[model samples]
Each structure stands twice: as C-alpha cells, then as structure tokens.
Target: MSDFIGDWYALLVLLLAGFLPNEVWRMLGLWLGGGVDEESELLVWVRAVATAILAGVIAQILVLPPGALASIPPSLRYGAVAVGLMVFIVAKRSILAGVICGELVMLIGKWWLG
Candidate 1:
C-alpha cells in the first residue's frame, strides 16, 4: 500500500493519458451541441467518426487483446460477439443480457479450448 501510494504520480499520469482523448470529445460535444441540430451534416459527421473510433477499439480488443484474451483464438472471440449480439436481439436489446451472454460464451470457449 505504501509502495502504491508512492507511485501516485505514475497513476495520475496514466489516468490523465487515458482521460484526455475522451475529455476532448466531451468538450467538443458540449461546444457543438447547443447550436447543432440532430440531422445536420456536422452532427452526422461527428457521429460517424465516433462510431468508427468505437468500432476500431472494439475490433482491436477482440482481435488483439492483451493478457488472457490474447491466448484465445480469434474465431472464439468473434463467435462470442456474434452470439452476444444474437442474445441481445432476442432479449429485446437488453445490454445486460448481451454482455453477460458474451462473457459467458467467451469463458466457456476459453475453458474448452484450454
């Protein structure tokens, strides 16, 4: 605990690094939101960009994860996602059901494969 406290600066640096990009986007949204209409081209562009960034992040996590997930096959990762989406759709788009099903599928796949 003392060692962890002594490394507070490192933690602060990491937290800032992780936060700055999202903070910039949040600030941008606030700045633009008051004047922009939902159907406007600028808003559409922003939405597209945000969606692309989110998709890229998810893709990277599933395809090139670090730690334990890195050991799992890509097919299993994607299969879990597909099953999760199916569960989400079948469960009236409940995010909790989707996430739980996806994680459970992944865990089962990992165990079976291992």
Candidate 2:
C-alpha cells in the first residue's frame, strides 16, 4: 500500500470520478422506473432510443475505432459482430453469450490474421 501510491490514487479517482456518478444515475433510473409499465409507450420509446444509441456507438467503433482496435481489420470486426449477433439470437438473447462470443471471434481473428 505504501509503495503503490500512484495505482491507489488512480483507483480512488476511478471510483470517485467514474463509478460513483454512474451508480447515482443508475439508482435514480431504477427508482424513477419502478412504477413505469413495461408496455408503456414512453418506456418503449426510451428502449428504442437506447438501443439505437448503442447500435450507433457500435457502428462507430467498428468503422473508426480508436487505439489498438483500429489496427484490427474492418472485416474481422464486422465478422465478430455478425457472429456475436448470431450467438445472441441462438442463445435466447443472452447478452453474456453474445459478448463473449464476439470477443472470442475478434481475438481468434486477430491471431489468425496475424
């Protein structure tokens, strides 16, 4: 603890500056959404908007990723996404399955390509 001041400070900053703020909003959302009907039009619209935003972000990442992700070929990235989607559907919309499969695909593709 005494020797790793920088690492501890970074962790503290991450918890205070990032995790706490996100957690507050998440808790607020949970409270606010507690009474909202799942079938309500507003909820549906919000879900759609959130999905669209996520899709857009994913598209942007695939198209023009920053850092090391950009070094991977576009084909590999797109192929991973496709495989992930397939796994997602085949696995009964399991997000964990989709993400794990997608990451595995990306890693294998990168290794194979290299």
Which has the greatest TM-score? 1
Tens-digit lDDT string for candidate 2 (1-113): 66655677788999999999889978987888767677989879988998999999989989999999989999999999999999999999999999999999999999988
Q: Clashing pairs in model 1?
A: none
Which 10 consecutive residues of model 1 have the lowest summed lDDT?
2-11
Q: Which candidate number maximizes lDDT?
A: 2
* lDDT tens per residue, model 1, 34-109: 7767798987997899899999999999888989888888998899999999999999999999999999999998
Return the TM-score for candidate 2, rounded to 2 decimals.
0.60
User: Cα deviation of 21 in candidate 1 (Å)?
Assistant: 4.0
Candidates in order have lDDT scores of 0.89, 0.91
RMSD of each: 2.8, 4.3
lDDT of 2 at 73: 94
C-alpha lDDT of residue 14 in model 2 = 96
Clashing pairs in 2: none
